[model samples]
Target: MDKEFFTPRTLGDAIGVSQSSLKRWADKGLLNVEKTAGGHRRIGMEEALRFIRESGVTVVKPDLLGLGSEDLEVQEDELSSADRLYYALHSGDETRVRSLVLNQYLDGRPLYEIFDEDIQPAMARIGLLWHDEVSGITIEHRAHDICLQVLADLRFRLPRVFTKGTAIGAAVPGDPYTLPTAMVSTALRGEGFSAVNLGPNLPIEALLDEAKKIKPVIAWLSVSHLRKAHILRTEIKELARELREQNTFLVMGGSQIHKLRLDRDPYVLIGKNIHELVSISRGLVANIPQSSESKGEFS
Candidate 1:
């Protein structure tokens, strides 16, 4: 994809700063810029967005940067965040929902909060709608599509992870849900881990095969749907052992995983939510021994 670039003057105007100030900041390395063939300076859209977010600058004209051209400020007078999100998902308002979520992240809210606090509650309500009415199933399916679109956009805006420790994750076999595993990868990326999401319904063999190839620092499994309890437990036990042999930690989560025998150990970790997943993963990445505090949520 071609990168979008903005001139110093355009960015300055958008943020209500002068062209000279922008140029000076660029020269001082406060802002990143590139030179055109004609020797004029240009800032990539990512850098411009970064400056706007980190500097807490009010975008007077977001159109100049190809962001939300409409009102970006979230309306708080009428509905709660989760309620508003539910309405958007049910109504299939992709643009509005995208604005709502992307703006939250740009405002410094962590991805876990967006998942645990906003998307979780909203999706819970949506799950009910999937069976309540005739059009409910269609609405639910469309909502998933819209959510996937928004997630792709959000992932693009996430700062590229360049540090060490690759992490691989996937939804358990027979689990078709996409958001939980995707959210895990995104959250790990935010914490500077090279997260690789192998996607849903991935076989245990594939996960083990990939783990052997990459030797990821952390391997994650999300259990949103359990097709066969006995087989899945056996697979998870084996997966945990495979990871432990490589000195890798296994992190697992999702609502349907409670039935599994969660064990308290150095290499096997279970979480109730995305925040715990991040906490555990980062601890392992930093080699911060949490054996004292490492206990499963269901053990």
Candidate 2:
């Protein structure tokens, strides 16, 4: 057994693996390590024991000299990739965005999660700063464009044949912001629903046309701005009534809806969070209508 118990560098060097490889393995439940105050990863003796056991290697007395320092180096390389991505997003560095997105996709982080957690937060920060300084708009726009490109890269696994049940989502009028809608659309796709994303500036008529054409069991409207939501709600109420007659459920969300005054409109449902929307969608999927059952018209 090696004497140094909690030294990340020494142990990683001893094991001849990159620290990032060690971290990834750790993340996947293969090893244990202590993260230091300055965000550095350190390994302990118990962790080393666990790693050896998991690897099914002969438990010879561990020699620190022969393994080489590849582990620490690999860890650095992995961290470098994440760091570079963060830096590019923050600085509006477009040159490396495509390559970074491809690498991230290969690393197994879902595109929707990345857009929701990383890209959205990055844009929100930039947007807040842009209000105080005129130049911030350029940075915000660049980040947003790059994020859209990343979203476009996502390969949605559409069903080979026409499906009975599907879901539709869009941002309501005056809700030009699109990231949230995009995020929700991806989540729908992941949930096995054919999501027809109509993008921004969706009038009630256009939404109705889409709902009729797609014949989805569920329709989602996102409203990020409150004033626009107030205006859109009137239109949505009518559409909800119309959709309910056709046996379609209408769902509304976003910060705008969060602030709105909601009533007990059976035709309309409001989701407070992404999870709620997903649950509603799942229920809709499970309750799909059969061809023999004609949807009853509601008053």
Candidate 3:
């Protein structure tokens, strides 16, 4: 798991500020901190990130926060993060991949933006490796696993609290790709939903069964590689109908989503990107009652 909290000195060091300055900010209530049982101060990642975003401070040492190294400090367009990520993934450098992702995340970039602008573009290029023969396929699979690792690290960095109602998702059977559904979970989490990723390659019947059991506020299906379009269409239609009956919105997306040729149903939503999915989910979450544990600092 990635580091979650930081002391005033550590955060100051990470951002190139003095402890005295950080303490001063805490004293002024500009930065929030919690005291340990022994009296030392600790800053949660949520608060530290908030302070950075609101104050426009540069993260000079994001690695201390489990993000990335000095390369993260460089301003964009020199190589472009997507380009860098493509090369890193192609080379199967898991550490570099993790750093690139965590750096953007701790820098307070939105999960949706990161997916749309960086990870997806890089992975799309990496996907071309499938045609490059067995060695290429091995590299592509390795890249996929590395990305999953980065997502896990990012998940750990998020606060343990999730006050929003449940938001569940999965990839239908034959769509073995996992990143899209996992990315959906992270984005919805960012929007304050308890996003439950049911994972990939689940049969439509099994997906419907789980959706019924979870009774989520919203359900998502990622269709990266669809098979038997007609059967899937029928299954998806039934899923949408069931979700609508429960007042749960059904959101679907992926490169192959259009193959479903979905019918006109108000509860059925089709998104072209993570940004659109989050936008819709955010609105749905607004109407659902927050759990008893919800707080002003909810993330």
Candidate 4:
């Protein structure tokens, strides 16, 4: 899913409107806007699509917003699903959420595809709603709980056919987000790895210690927050150096990873999404010789 948020200028450029006009719409409650901690206005992709649909605005530069003309058609088909799921989540309607998610899964979509194309985008929209003050913290928490439950259920249902190797994944310290790690772990498992997800807020030292103990084929660190990028870079570099010595590949990803100027390390793989992470994990597992003691199994 495209998880990009945009500035008014970028949105204006894409939709062929003046920035002042966009701001005016925001002020008139025609467009929803979120404010950053520093008070800069931000717009989510879903909201942009909504505005385009409702106002009959032509999106001339869809690529500037990580979308295409075809996406507008997709928006027409899937927007209602996303909208219903959002409202169901806010109202704590687990059954409806489950039915909607399961309908996609039962329609023969792969779990990873569902996560990347549907669930993640839905969550991103809900997150923006929270940021825009259209939803409360309780609603956000409830939505997360439902999402985790659905993911867990899907993980249990995935066929364990390929048995590649073992992988350990975690969110970095101070990054207390869970869904990204869960997505990584599920993607690894789908690729036939014995995946262990040490979810959110794990200190670097502790993660390194676990890596040493498990001797995994891949160690993944996900960073979702951009605050303290310098500290995270230092910790990640150290972890990469240590994992390199152990011949354990390190995979790092998340929305905020692009902000860091990381050194070029061949053993350290950077993934922008779950699909990339799964591809990297498959490649690493394929090239590395499995230890005699290592056996792949669901954990």
Candidate 5:
């Protein structure tokens, strides 16, 4: 049996919730689970964290598996759209949330509504809900996983010609949030570019190696979280300088860029949002006259 499939009763026990409640949630599709042949259900730690975030309820582990009692406390804060989405996520209603966004899109709702109203707010609340704790990390991972899944599903095919001179990439350094990178990748695909995503905590050397191999026309660096700003910036600056010599455009953005004062580095450009980034990329493609477009190979 795969170790990943090992039954996870530990999470439920940690939360002090009855197996029945968890099963009921799974049945309603409000909780996600996996079942074994004998009909035993298993849950994920991510789902458990989401549940705690939405409920804002504390669980005091009177017995920490074998150690002493653990006291868990929850905090109250003014809820935002992000929090509402967190609740939905904890409830394991990915389908419902996706349906709502898709329906709005079909009804001619603006992209801004889908992002600003539907997605961004939900992200904010998730952050606040998990401000501190190991469980917060679990919620963070779940949020990123769900967002990436949604973005992948939304990426439709593009015209063949549009792929001739364009490339896209995503990187998370400086504690950047995952949603922005995933969101930008989706947007880039929608605009007819081939995108490559190298997720969080990527080392600078690995980034350089990948870029050299893939040789993307442009790369995106997201900085939603600022915890590692200086270190990430310094490494990225060095990489950008090196990559520029090879003719790659390094673009960056996220909350940190907006808040911090970063010096001008010609090789690096910051985008305010997805629209700006796409427009910039399109311009880069247009600059390379038709005859020059065929030289760069896509990986």
Candidate 6:
């Protein structure tokens, strides 16, 4: 079978599990692994995903395992596009970046797919370059600006059905990443929700106030950094409680969300990727018969 393989360490890092835990799982046959000629263990991408889904483990890095996007036929094309975009961004080629993004949009690619399968993963790879000191801050900033502009353009062009309930999204304070929130907002919009994006670095109080005002059916928090985990945990707990009182569901995601070590709550939804976010949003929206009745009132 044609398959992708990951080293135990790489798989562990991608899934946020300890290497020892992965080895233990492998030993217990929870994970399907193969032995190389040198007796090194390697895990298949499909088996890893199966284990993750069955074990109820949240994947913090879906891109690493190629799990989010369903458009497999476009995978190679998207990867090539991402590589070109990365090179263009590094060179500060704004024209090329815009053309690449718009071309994908014009070719009938969904905004969420572009973001999830292409832009986000490319940015993540670029982030590694920054972290490793291979790329300077200026290049990173330029790339982010270009991505923001493209996402804004996409948001403007997205067709609004608004059959689903309102969604309010923000990146929690102390998490300076903007793209994750933008992706979530855009995906919600694409999924027929009236999505209000609160953008990045929003204080919990501000988000709470906005949630109260909007009374959104879904309130999404994107936590990209784990620096202020203690503070974030407190804010998230308080916000969840308030949202629960308001009868609004809270959806949380991002790379560092697993770090919070939160206990699962019935009203709080945790998504590992944009696909799951869309799925959760659809489920919640499906139950909101009121939105269907009052669609014209909001628009």
TM-score of every candidate: 0.90, 0.61, 0.88, 0.68, 0.58, 0.69
Best by TM-score: 1
Index of the highest-lDDT prediction: 3
Cα lDDT tens digits for candidate 3, 102-166: 76765677888888999999988887878867788888889899999888777756655666677
Runs of candidate 6 exceeding 4 Å displacement: 1-79, 131-135, 291-294, 297-299
RMSD of 5: 13.9
- The global C-alpha lDDT for each of the candidates, from Candidate 1 onward, is 0.81, 0.63, 0.82, 0.78, 0.60, 0.77
Minimal lDDT window, size 10, model 1: 290-299
lDDT of 1 by residue, 1-299 (tens): 78778988899988889999998888898899999999999998778877777877777776676666556444564777678788889899998788788767766778889888988888888888757687888888888888888888887776663364678989988999998899888888777777889999999889999999877778899999889889888887888888889887788999998877666667888889999987887677577443422221110
User: Model 5's lDDT to the true fold?
Assistant: 0.60
Error of 1 at 196 (Å): 1.3
TM-score of 4: 0.68
The order by descending lDDT is 3, 1, 4, 6, 2, 5
In model 5, the Cα lDDT at residue 277 comes to 72
- Give the per-residue lDDT of model 4 (tens digit) for 1-299: 34458999999998899999998999999999999899999987656655765577766676675543333334446566566667767788776677566445544555667777777777887776666575567688889999898778666655554377678989888888999999898888777888889999898899899999978888998889766889888988999999999888999998887887789999999998887887787688678776655653544
lDDT of 4: 0.78
Stretches off by above 4 angstroms in model 4 are 1-84, 131-134, 160-162, 295-299
Please identify which of the two predictions, 2 or 5, would achieve the higher TM-score against the true structure.
Answer: 2
Deviation in Å, model 2, residue 277 alpha carbon? 3.2
